[model samples]
Target: MSSPVALIATAKLRREDIDAFTTWQGRHEAAAATFSGFLSSDLIPPGKDGHDEWTLILNFQTADQLTIWQHSAARASLIAEALPFFIGGNTGQAMAGDTAHDTSVTGVTGMIFSRIKPGMEGRYREWAVRIQAAQTKYPGYRGIYLQPPATSGKDATWTTFVRYDTRAHLEAWMTAPERATLLEEAEEFVDNMELVRLATAFPGWVPVNATTGQGPPDWKTALLVLLGLFPIVMLELRFLNPTFSAWNMNASLATFIANALSVAVTSFVTMRLFVRWFDWWLFPNAHRPADTTLKGLILLFMLFIGEIGALWWLLP
Candidate 1:
């Protein structure tokens, strides 16, 4: 199972009151633990954008857990204490929570895009690699992928990918001198630019074991068996014998009908087996601990229903 994740909740704060907000944040973390479903939290200050705002990224076992924390008295008190000093506004206003799909990532993937000038694409890539090498050398860098310009439209763009032990580490990386150099070198290629700090927390299902292993026992296998038998059964009941009277035909018809009925009955009986096997083998039901296992199980069951009932029809 992947680790359950949450978003980096951002809010702007006065630079003078940063110390005060930091202190309050520590207290809030302690207070938060008292609430049900608490996992962990981190404090991130403003980086290259050069603002006084700070961001707090939190993680929980599930959306239900976050809902509980939001309404907790401690959470209310903490927000009340810290709201007055923010610049981008308060947590309850600018901040919104998006549930994560990839529980593998502790926090969301934040991306910033910079475009290259017509002739500077080659040099821009050179600087990008240097920045990436520096970034990869750093503790939190995951890996980077660069998407060059497609044949049709705008110039090429550059992206950087970094992982953080905490959001604080990420914020620090952003503000570091190497990033400043990257930004400076980037200006040569860039004309009109855009930066986006995204939160990749939307939820979805993913397959578990794709390679050699005992796969899940589900209706997929049973359905395959039924499909294979369909042609053979039709031939046996309807076309095998050439000589037969009307009464003989009626008896033969009865035997054919009985065989079809048995097949349908067996498929219906094994439907649950299919669901259980698929749910267990496919989705990230084990990402959280055993105490939260039931919630994951329920989520997987819903996924199974959607897949077998709706998705099958929708897909080609």
Candidate 2:
């Protein structure tokens, strides 16, 4: 079977057009949903005081299905309708393989677009490999995905997606003197460059630190999610399931409702309360003491045990 494919589309819009652009994008997404093999889509807006570029990622079961959507009249019409809101024409590239379809990707991603000077593609590619190798030595480095311009000919823009474990770690590499030297070296082979930061993956699950722009690590976040979710699941299985059965609700419908409630409660209530109480542990300072970590783990463990004990007692 073919690997799943993700189409990454980017557009630049003026500040004044953002509201109108978002409305148009909603319609565009609605149209895309009707197409075959559409798995999911994520629209990432620019950050506060950040650049004007908006990114849309559409995941499809196969590249063929994505190609159909790309060439469909519905998409073309929507693109035309959206032209007035765009500062420039949009650009898109289809990415396949492991990195593109990596569902577990979290933290921050830097999308770097570089335009190579005429006749310098070969040399620029060699330099890209070297810079990627250099970046691997940095702390919290995840991986990088590179894509050349979707269409051939005069457009020589290369898109590079570099992911790091956190915003602080990403910024460290971005501002490092070694990277600056590499950028300076690329002056001969590069004509222009733009970098956009995307802090997505699991939005609204964990609040980012204002100063660091970093959230708790994935493992910590997952553990907290389990801490909140376990009781919710147990309670629903105990109380909600019986009530639904008494009401004669369809099995599928009950499952859907249960999931919706789980997500809503987890995102809005449980996570917010837990995050507030665990703020210090969640967003520890760079030099956080070992005891701080140990204490936080002990507290979390105790909470889990208490929840289990109470639920076991009450459920029966």
Candidate 3:
């Protein structure tokens, strides 16, 4: 069976042309939907404080279908219509599989776009390897994925996705003196660079507001995670441990199984239920009274106590 595919396209636009570009983008999406095997499309606009680049992701069932859409006359015409609004011509990269819809991401991600100077691709790649190595030495470093220019010839743009466990950890890597030195050295090979930070406590598990591109704050997410996780851990210790011991499973393997089950349960069942029940608390409106936060905290505290009390009775 063919793997799913996604095309991620980005365009830079001037401030004044945003409205026109948005209207044109709607037409573009309409045109794309007419193609065969098209699954879905998502438009991520620029954040309030970042680069003015808008990203559009298109998912299709197969690469052949995506190729057909890309090479079609309808897409060409739409691109031509939208070209006037672009500051720099649009660029795109394709990833195989359903990466576009991946929600298992657990940290902050930085999307870096760099334009390498002519004939410096080799040097830039070498630099990338070194910088990647340097970042791995830092605390909370997750991983990085790099993509070369989507098109052949004069287009030298490269896209990179770097992840760290939290915004503070990511910022530590980004603002470190080592990174600063690397950037200084890169000046010889790189013409321009842009970094966009995507902040989310639990990306796929927690919904991000379309306009704001943000999820609930980290503290709230942590508290919710604890609330959901505590019961699971307690129940595992009470019921699952004896079964594992009976099966002669070692501590390491038993612990691994327990963690895996906990993560799966939290991700699929508990998190969803909690998010739904606490939607108002998770995303209170801007004008919501301050006590709204306190009220939610109090409610959570009560739930914690209730869980502890119930488990105490059930276990012992």
Model 2, which residues run further than 4 Å from truth? 1-201, 286-288
Order of all candidates by TM-score, from best down to worst? 3, 2, 1
Q: Encode model 1's per-residue lDDT on 1-316: one tens digit a residue.
A: 3345464567776657755665565556556544455554545545444554555656565666777777777788878877786667446321234332223445434445556677765566456545554553344433232333333135545443345555655656666777766766566766534333421121111111211112323443444344334444444445443333443667667677657765664445433344345443332233435645356457556655654564343323
Of 1 and 2, the candidate ahead on TM-score is: 2
Provide the lowest-lDDT 10-residue window in model 3: 206-215
**lDDT, candidate 3, 186-214, per-residue tens:** 87988767565445757667775322335
- Cα RMSD, each candidate: 21.4, 18.4, 16.0
lDDT for predicted candidate 3 compared with the true structure:
0.75
Q: Could you give candidate 2's per-residue lDDT for residues 1-316 as a string of tens digits?
A: 9888888878888867765665665556556656777765555555334555677677777899999999999998988888877776455788984234243556677767788888887777667656765766677765555555644456657777777778788988887778877877887888766565434345666665433344567777777888999999998999999999999999999999999999999999998888778877877765577688778889999999999888877576
Better of 2 and 3 by lDDT: 3
Q: Native-vs-model 2 lDDT?
A: 0.73
Arranged by lDDT with the best first, the candidates are 3, 2, 1
